[model samples]
Target chain A: MNAYWQCLRGIVLREWLRFVLQRTRFLSALVRPLLWLVVFAAGFRAALGISVIEPYDTYIPYEVYIIPGLACMILLFNGMQGSLAMVYDREMGSMRVLLTSPLPRTFLLCSKLLATALISLLQVYGFLAIAWVYGVQPPAMGLLLALPALLLVALMLSALGLLLSNGIRQLENFAGVMNFVIFPLFFLSSALYPLWKMRDASQWLYWLCAVNPFTHAVELVRFALYERLAGLALAICLGLTVLFTLLAVLTFNPQHAALRKPG
Target chain B: MNALTVQDLSFAYGPCQALCEVGFSLAPGRFAALLGPNGAGKSTLIALLTRLYHLQRGEIHVGGHSLRDAPRAALKQLGVVFQQSTLDLELSVEQNLRYHAALHGLSRRHTDLRVEAELARQGLSERRREKVRALNGGHRRRVEIARALLHEPRLLLLDEASVGLDPASRLGLNQHVRQLCREHDLSVLWTTHLLDEVHADDALMILHQGRLVASGQVDALVQEHDGDLGRLFAGLTRPTATGAPA
Candidate 1:
């Protein structure tokens, strides 16, 4: 019993404490979405128009359309940021200490991912509260429904981040990942604009948005804000979470070259 | 029972071999030193012993548990201080130890008591609350040593842990580790490039170019070379004109 709680307590506290130690990291997580909410959304409000979507009964402002995206942006960056911390820990040798423990490596890694997901959830709520101050408020009951959706998105994103961290060899290579993964993932999804708007530009972009797992993630949050359920979003997000988590575990397997320290 | 054993352990990186046909074993409570120069594969061997890498050819066992078949159990019986500092500089000494203890699943009540006992055992109680960044190099090493012992492992492996320390600190650390082996009946495998660090009774293995050329008690090996361990080490490791197959 002590062992079970310790595993949960240890990794959770360690991950949270690491983020707390760097207050700037948390601020940056909040600030990035805030920038999108304030400057980018303000500038692009007129350029992009919105039709009444399924989740929105009446016509809604563009600021409201992108709020879900900004919430997702927080989860995306913060989740990957946690993975980056793992790489730093590996290079600094503290990862070796953690890896040598008696606990199964899978459990240890999962514990970390769960902690990261929880932190991402907190950041999403913080961003939502800030967005409310800007006159973009979800139904008060909608906020309650958003919790489970936010958790699912965070889990999926954090798993993807862990998988990438396990594969990347050097710190220098991580920048390329941000551009290839975060940039494309955020841009190709329904984060910035709805899929129908992308179809107006190109069928290919719309198809990309249709297949993107992130599209489902944003859709999940968007509908939750209006007290609606996204069955497709739930399936896609949960499926991707399991897929990415399996990849992470395989990559960290003792047989893998990248996971091992050179003798 | 042997505390640790390795049989024909071999590994390679792409085309370059890192370890080839390496083998050794240490009895319970014995102290052994793996002596080699830079790029001689001493660090590589330590990595293998710690199960940081899986070998293509060979077997490693700790207290009778196979590394390949039971890594978590094997690792639980072994402790390691790597060549690089593993301490979290942003955390205090006690925080670092507590984090490790929790990972090993020690209860909060036990972790506190064990942390105090370990700090006292490592002669670090006075500095327990100090941030790791504030500690000097030697003190940081001490923190790592105390951390490796927090779980009370039967085998301890140190990879070039004394490098860059002042002479007095190095001697102090060596003495302290040797004392731990005696007091706790822990088997120790210490890797170092410095010949002076090898004691007369300690078993020594000379490795060069990924091959083990010599293994025996230091005093016996020195006697075989007429009381010249350095010359023997060089002659065995230096490439000969014939370049005989290792």
Candidate 2:
């Protein structure tokens, strides 16, 4: 309906405005991946030569191989940060205004997830634009094809973030959890090294990387960026997006966050 | 028809009961004040009424729609201003109002019209483009009021809306809301701990220890307990000789 469209527009517009106003957030989002591409990848290029994979047509340097993973890294961090803001909103009273809407709670939450995903996409592109100038270019059409793949990963991660935030009692405790989640998700996956590389390191470590949803998310982007279809990865990302979003909606208890602790 | 109704509503946080057997109703276009001291379960009752917490034991109807069975319809007819300010401080007044209107599913034209009308009604038209952070506490509260009314719900529920205001600002805000009730025929249930905010002619309800201790017209309840409002409140809500809530 027109009403839902208007609501979606308003939510997205608010996020866009906030994103524009907070210059530091955008810069910080860029800094993390840029460091990996410019510094980490440069340092490791001689040590890790990437073979031609299913998505890559030829041998590539470490920087080119990690570009897709780093793009997803932006989504991963932004997604969790978006949920952190949700916790902050609940504490600060703005969430009460949001929850009182006449729309179904499920719809409101979905709109929020989609809006945050949309914003994450913008940040991903910003990182990609900088990477483009740094000689990490993919095929022009492949960049366009990667749009939906990136969006799906964004939604999946943001939904996971929201679900995680539901159980977090306070903002002070969030940084510890973030480091716990982000490091393992980034390091254990194919972000820095391929699954085969992990297999050479340890079988259990390789299995962990194989099963990580973040790994599939990275592969989804990696394949799409080369104009290849990652059917299995696409299915897994879609399934987890639905599953996490449902759980997030079901477990969301605004009262628990909004109530004052008894003194 | 009553604009709002609650029957035997009860809620608990784990083992601790926050509200019990709470019941009340408000006729359309009337102003009723809910008064209670701190720790007296006012916030809990508001949370239940606003559907922030699920109904654990009983029923609530807003504008003839049951909250449990038909929440969307019920919520559509109800507006709430929570104890904490819910405005987005980084947003301009107009932007905040527009977001609320959109959440209520208003068309752009309708949102513009209602935004204009409510801004004028709250005397906030000149400050429409000002960021909420720039406004004083009193003005921010008015912006929330305007936002709550944009959808034109029949019932307006405010929980401790006058807290932290200057004495003059509090009085002015209270009077402004009362004027809204009279002019717009809107039903209002305002919660506050301040006794002076309740007029003798207005409907009054006192809550204590998660129970509704007394409820009726203010002057009548005062006369029934004693001639003094303060004594009546103290006697009803204070601990008894046996260490139970009076």
Candidate 3:
């Protein structure tokens, strides 16, 4: 019990230290979403009219409306980037240090997932902090309320990212896969445009947005940031997080033949 | 009791067999050297021993715990230094050791004491705060050794751990590990293709193409195979599929 706690603490601490050491990662993480908030949102502010949504009491600016989605975007990119690092670790032999732990592989992998998720959350909050100064303030209480919701989405995306990266045979292909997964998950979901806008664009596209777990993740954060509850979104995020974690743990073995993670 | 044991062990990567019917045991305090050429499945065997790859057939027991049936317990009693360096170059030596200790579930007090002790033992206490990337290859390997020993496993396995070291560093590392084995009563299975690393009295196992071709005391095997270590190794591990011409 105490061992589990220590292990988790250590894993998180290592990740935090690494995150600190790599200043460029944090900077890029912020720069991506802030680009959307400052530039993309300004460009779309007049073009896309956001109606009264459940979390928003009145009409909201594009910048205000897309904050949750962009927050989730940070998670999405971090999740994939974390997976790429996992593959890199495997090849470079650092992963041997991890798998050799006497702890159950499942527990170790989860510790890693939680560690990456926490680090991603730091970047998300950083983005939110900048957004607050950018005149896109939610309630102070709502900001506090969004932490747990954002954490769930982070875990879900990290787990899903790990599961997806397991199939990647070469590290060189990681960028391609990242662009492939990130673009679809970002654009097809309610991250940029609202679901109503998607429906207006195409019925099938709207269905894809509705069913995409990222949409529910975005909605969950969107609601939590306003001190409300999206029950269905919460349920979906919780369920998918568990599912992705289990699937990731199950398929986590190093492939003996291809050494998918290594050369 | 034997510190480590394997029986009828076999593994395959698709159609290519990595190990076959290979069985051996390490006595509680002996230093055993495993010799194999590049294509000789040494890495595969090490991967299986460290639980990096799942077993397709056979059994492995580490300090009486079956690796397949009880991996956690089995791993708890085993420590390994892989062929490739596993330390995070970005982390300080002390930080790397702490991470390993935590993975093994050591308490804070235990971790501090163990880290200090192992670093001192490895002559690395002064470099605890130095990032691993700043250290030379030999020093980094020592850090890995200290980390591997922190949990105090009964057996230590090194898979070609001295690959890139200079001749002096390689011999120094080898001698250091032997001294550690004697002082600590820890069993070791050191794998390498270098014949000079094998002492006449140490337990020796030469693997060839997934098979244990010869295993016994090096002196006795030397006596049996015409008193020449090089010829014995070459004769036994000829590239032919049949092996040894026996």
Q: Name the top DockQ candidate.
A: 3
TM-score of chain A of 3: 0.96
lDDT tens per residue, model 3, A2-93:
98998989999999989999999999999999999999999998899999978788998899999999999999999999888888887787
* lDDT value, residue A148 of candidate 3: 97
- Tens digits of per-residue lDDT for model 3, B121-174: 999999999999999989988998999999999999998999999999999999
Candidate 1 lDDT tens digits, B69-132: 9987788889889888988888889988988888888888889888999999988999998999
Q: After superposition, how far is residue B73 of candidate 1 from its true place, in Å?
A: 2.0
Cα misplacement distance, residue B32 of candidate 1 (Å): 1.2
TM-score of predicted structure 1, chain A: 0.95
DockQ of 2: 0.60
> After best superposition, candidate 2 residue B86: deviation in angstroms?
1.1
1 versus 2: better TM-score goes to: 2
- Give the per-residue lDDT of model 2 (tens digit) for A119-172: 999999998899999999999898999999999999999999999889888888
CAPRI band for model 3: medium
Q: Which of the two candidates, 2 or 3, achieves a greater DockQ against the reference?
A: 3
- In candidate 3, how many Å is residue A169 off? 1.7
User: Per-residue error at A20 for model 1, in Å?
Assistant: 0.8
lDDT of 1 by residue, A40-95 (tens): 98898888878888899888788999999889989999878877877777766677
Docking class of 1: medium
